[model samples]
Target chain A: AQSVTQPDIHITVSEGASLELRCNYSYGATPYLFWYVQSPGQGLQLLLKYFSGDTLVQGIKGFEAEFKRSQSSFNLRKPSVHWSDAAEYFCAVGSAEGYSTLTFGKGTMLLVSP
Target chain B: EAGVTQFPSHSVIEKGQTVTLRCDPISGHDNLYWYRRVMGKEIKFLLHFVKESKQDESGMPNNRFLAERTGGTYSTLKVQPAELEDSGVYFCASSQGYGETQYFGPGTRLLVL
Candidate 1:
């Protein structure tokens, strides 16, 4: 079974500061990774995805994630944080054989301080 | 184009009561998915629908939960005689087809007391 582990429960960062949310996964084969953000009273939005090439994938809102095959990790990072970027971040893993049904992590809640 | 939309954003009901949740996926999206997030838990896949057919329902908790997409349009998930453990946020998502990013809808929060 493929599982995603987001070790951070909640992370607080000052506005304009760099931010990084760690995500680790355990899968048998090449994995499809994704990062999603959910704001209060809103739906989850895709931040980025990693499937084949390009170990580092860029997403909307200046977010980027690097997929390390050896580390089995796909961590999300941003050069600067904004108050509007405060939301819940989830790391999910899926397999091509699984028909793309995702198995998500427990999620990390991000709080940006002004 | 309109994103996925779910009806009755929040619902509070007593245990053993029936609750039905509806979802309208994005226009022309052929794949619809159902997922849920229990309190303090990760969002989990409940099922997947390809058009009007049940492509995969292995994630559904039990027989009490029934989901249908009539005429390959709007989909409904009905939980009959809901249990207290069923309290959670139910999310609906859609995609143009297989191997595509799924667009999500604002979830329906169900509280079973």
Candidate 2:
């Protein structure tokens, strides 16, 4: 079975500071990776997804992630974060078999301070 | 177009009581899924429905949890004799097709008191 691990349970960053969230996954084959963000009392919104081709994938809200095959990691990065960026971020991995469901990490809470 | 919508944003029920949660997927979406997130845990898949038929229900916790979709449009998840463990946020997602990106709903927060 595949699984995901997010080493950081909580991350605090000052407004306008750069941010990076770590994510690692364990899967047997090539995996489809995704990053999602959830605000308080709101549903999850897709931050980005990586299926194939480019190793670096750009997402909305000026967020990006790079897929590193060697490291088995797909970490999310932003040049600058706003207070509104504070939320819970989840990292997920899906198998190539098609029928497989997504395995997600426990999530990392990003706290952006003023 | 509206995103996936779930009924009763929050619900509080006594233990052993029966509760039903509804999910209305995005129109024209052929795939719908149910997932739950318990406190301090990752969001876990409960089941998947392709139209009106259940394609995979392996993630369902137990027989006490029942999910159904009629007319391949909306879905309902019912839990009978709910336990404290069942208290969590239930999220419903829909995809255009198999292996496609899924759009999630606001979720129904169930509190089993």
Question: Best candidate per lDDT, number?
Answer: 1
**Fraction of the native A-B contacts that model 1 recovers:** 0.88
Structure candidate 2, residue pairs in collision: none
Which tens-of-lDDT digit does each residue in A1-114 have in candidate 2? 889999999999999999999999999998999999999989989999999999999999999999999999999999999999999999998875575377889999999889
After TM-score superposition, the amount by which residue B65's alpha carbon in candidate 2 deviates from its true location, in angstroms, is 0.4
Q: Write the per-residue lDDT of candidate 2 for residues B1-113, one digit (tens) a residue.
A: 99999998999999999999999999999899999999999999889999999999999999989999999999999999899999999999999978878888999999999
- Mind sharing the TM-score for model 2? 0.98
Displacement of residue B25 (Cα, Å) in model 1 is: 0.7
Each model's TM-score, in the order given?
0.98, 0.98
Show where candidate 1 strays beyond 4 Å.
Answer: none
Compared with the true structure, all predictions reach lDDT values of 0.94, 0.94
Candidate 1 residue-wise lDDT, B1-113, digit = tens:
79999998999999999999999999999999999999999999999999999998989999999999999999999999899999999999999978678889999999999
